[model samples]
Target: MSRKEDGTLVLNKTKIFDTENCYIYQRGGTESKYWQFYYWDSEGREGFRIRKSLRTKDFLIAQSLAQREYINIRAKIQNEESLQTLTVAEMTNIFLAKKKLDISSVPHAGITPETYRILKNRCEKLNNFLGKDTRVDHLKRSAFKEYEQWRKDGYGGKVPKTKTTIKTELSTFKSIIQDIAIKDKRVISNAPDIPKITIPPSEDEHRRNHFRHEELRVLIGTINEWKEEKTLRKTAGLHRQMIACAIELMLNSGIRVGAVRKIRWRDIRVNPKDNPKQQKIFRIITIPSENNKTGKQYECNCEIALIVEHLKRISRFNSPSDLLFCNQNDGKTFSSRIWADCWNEIIKRSGLEEESGRRFSYYSLRHTYATVSLANKVPLQLLASNMDTGTKYIQDHYYHHETEELTEELNPIKRTRKMTADEMLAQYLPQKI
Candidate 1:
């Protein structure tokens, strides 16, 4: 068959489906003209090909039916596509490609950059367990447990992987396999069911506490010192300075690292709602769904205007296309995922690297922001909205009051500009709605 430039398809002898290895056939003698469409049936590998009768002696009618059936097969292959069609490795690659696409662009399923990193890691685990080339349709659904056990055994049962770790790996494996499988009906049931492995509460990692004020101070001061030191000593300091800016940004506004890394100069506004602009206070940072984890674009009133100003002044390129905190060495975007060396090192240097107590990472900065904001009586309802997190989460997790005396320092006498519910909706929402 030939595909015309005007997008019309022309039928040719023998082959009907362009993508598949399909062709027309006839019984015994050519004179009989009992035409039939013979195509390879991949439904299971039990049979080599399926023979379907076009039920017509007329050549034109047989061609028409062949085209119709060919189209139907092509649609199924398309819907169940795995590049050249239905193999584990090709499908996994496609799935990861889609996730990376979602991470970089809009109209995504909210897979964060961190989540994409994890997905790739999970794919590796699956490949190690089952060879990447294994046909997805060939596996028995119950064999998932055999995989769970195989991971639990962990290479001849010597260096046993953690129960939590093994569970996560197999569960992710099952998810990727099942997602591709049943979406196009590789199996009968509501997807091939993977048996649930019990993850005991005792084995779960605890929720973290926010960084102490002193720890935050030390970290920031140390980073600032790194930035100001002499030229030779300040080589590594450039990256640290970027880290400090990222910390300050997240500390004032609870935007995650995944979202923060994508923020370009064009996304910021220095108090656009205020006349003459208030440089002393936080302005605004818009986190759109393409970068943000929540998959929602929203405004954040943040004190990072000063920080942003400093960054632009020091930045090699201050154009709208340039990122806020890029790699100091190469001026490229940092991190395959968060927790670049500087963050962990700084936390360790700050002496916040706890052995048993609450641990702090780059995410701790966000938690610290929420904790400190709540302590300042920033209004819990508004804080949750501003953070783009749940009010219930704030109440349950981050609402521990530090001290009553510390709260008195704010002295509610000074007027503050906080957006009311109606005002917030008016600003963030489209008026056409």
Candidate 2:
């Protein structure tokens, strides 16, 4: 309908072209033979674009050809059978941008960063190895096994990557290409299966990441000491206390650090239904589906009921909408900063850093809650549900081999009185001779 500056005038922009971006446009003048069907096609090696060709001399014929080509493109997209013509680098950028948009678009998702930095790094490594090229289309599904070996053995001058690391990268890679291919009308269904990689028994086998009861007690005592020493009218002291609260909360409730950071004062209350007499603070922390990773509402009971009550009394933000652990300055959730500050200080001051064989972070609190609960005879399925994970994962990854706990359940052997040495010798010798 309109002529583009220094470009061809579009004959018409109709519904047929909107979804797939395929339409008719004349290059120079509106000569009928100059009419072209600008449609997406994988006929040539240039990996996917508005593939143009002079279809007919008549405008009406051009429209018919364009529509037919668009139909074929749509069919290819729906069937996921179209050849992907995008370079690996282009797909990587699109995928990362999409991931950023997903997090930002969702409110109260609890993830603070827009960048998936780790995944980005992996993608970059993939780009470096694959050369950011259209040759990515030549990646044969049959060659996936060879590619896996090349990844493991450091072939083609690429750095050797671990199975877990490579698996994550390949998953991202698969997701990216499939999405772009479908969107670009290159493919229609799910991407072909990438070869599976095995996770070694020792891969991330830090099963001792949980704290023992005595150690947890020591850590709590240290936190209390920290509160006493660090307590001041200044904002710094309050944040430290908040961090300590977060640790205690995670230790008891098995809530993730991400969910803990998004807690609001409005979400907490004493449920009278649970406490009919209203004599006790039957406190509850409501995790909304938006804030939780599982997208399920989880009501976490107060791990330390007294501490929860105390926080309620002394909270700087008492309003319903106020964040429970806000940054003292901005009045926003302090989850992003909690790890870099108070958690580090707690580990150092408690001497846990030097003693723990494995590195422990805020997540260890969740692990500890599960471990302690399991050791004390809590049901495995119940613990898994509480942890928002599977029973198999609990058995394989988080559960500690606390042999001492098992000893208590076994029947004790009765002790026989020791026979005198002469009586033992006579009994043995009579039989031996």
Candidate 3:
């Protein structure tokens, strides 16, 4: 037996080739008749041994297999490729496991549980589309070209998915490949190119379902009536008040429904000034990273201090740590079913849905806020920051063509002919009353 400087033990056992560091040998015992390929890799500071079964008893066949693998490994090392031989399924699993760890290790910068579920679903779709056994390194750019159509057709089902839904799913799929190949360095090759989905413009579609001012007034009126209804149980009344608070916060602050559901009393901060109006006018609301979809903590100015005061006056769970909108009996967040039922009832009673011919959800309040703010000429950058989104998104989704209300601004009188002196004087100067 001989030992190398790199700590590689050279056994004076069976050797098929005259290679110093790499060789093929067979171990004695009922370890079977299979030959083994052994290589001592000394590429890095710490050397390691690589061993694999050639799965053949014949010396020539084992020699051929060993040589081929050795050459391939050397070429990979030369190209600086990853040594991991992961399939699509294996890569997806690894990505998910890392994501799960990220949730605990870096909650502020990690994906939320809801986002995890969504990513898992997208990964399943990717696995189904491209066979799970497909090697990550072998993936080609052309493989994703038809994915949009395949996903849209609902995998040959009856109901086709919308382009918007397909676009989001494709984004998640692309992110998965990028995360594994580029970010994690798990693939031998660079990340494969994914085709982008071009979603057709759906201008004013978001605002169409949003509550108009008249509709909002009607909704508030319905809420006032429903919350104070005499037939409601004590716990039920508490729930309604919390729902009202949630609606007002979303309407005034443009906060997402999901983030609103997770708000705690301590998450809100009021101005320290003695002025009551100033305190109510300038409240800061913090959306925790775990509560929001983006997984990034941010604070936005909101005038919901008065509403918070009202909730504090009536809420059973008013402790700083308790959720502001929790169930009075158990201090738990309201279930999805409870929220949906209340919102549907509110819509049914408001009668705005019948008049407007559009359905409204909790998210409609946030949309309403954006639409109204844009109409009031709020700057795109300011509104985007308030909503924790991008200016381009606000411009694209909230820009409505219905500028009839702004006729004075959108289409001022254009003088094709010379204006009369009296007309010019009247337009330019204010007349004495």
TM-score of 1: 0.61
**What's the CA error at residue 392 for candidate 1, in Å?**
2.7
Q: Which segments of model 1 are wrong by more than 4 Å? A: 1-91, 97-104, 107-114, 133-166, 182-195, 200-208, 213-236, 272-278, 288-290, 328-332, 335-339, 347-354, 357-359, 401-433
lDDT of 1 by residue, 231-281 (tens): 654545666666778878888898887788888888988775666556566
| 10 residues in a row with least lDDT, candidate 2 | 105-114
Local error of candidate 1 at 258, Å? 2.6
lDDT string, candidate 3, 1-433, tens digits: 5554656454434443466778876664344767778886666434546788889989888888988888887887788765556788987898898887766423457666657776777788888888899988877778788887786666723333346677777777777777885566545445666777666655225444677667788999999998888654888887888898889989989999988988998898975653776885668889988777677888878778789889989887888999989888999988877888999898898888678766678878887888888888888888899899888777776666555567766543742557678988888897689
- Per-model TM against the reference: 0.61, 0.60, 0.62
| Stretches of model 3 off by over 4 angstroms after superposition | 1-16, 24-36, 39-50, 53-85, 104-108, 133-142, 156-161, 178-196, 203-210, 214-244, 256-259, 268-306, 309-315, 327-364, 373-402, 407-433
Q: Give lDDT per model, in order.
A: 0.68, 0.69, 0.77
Clashing pairs in 3: none
Q: RMSD for all candidates, in order, please.
A: 13.4, 9.5, 7.6
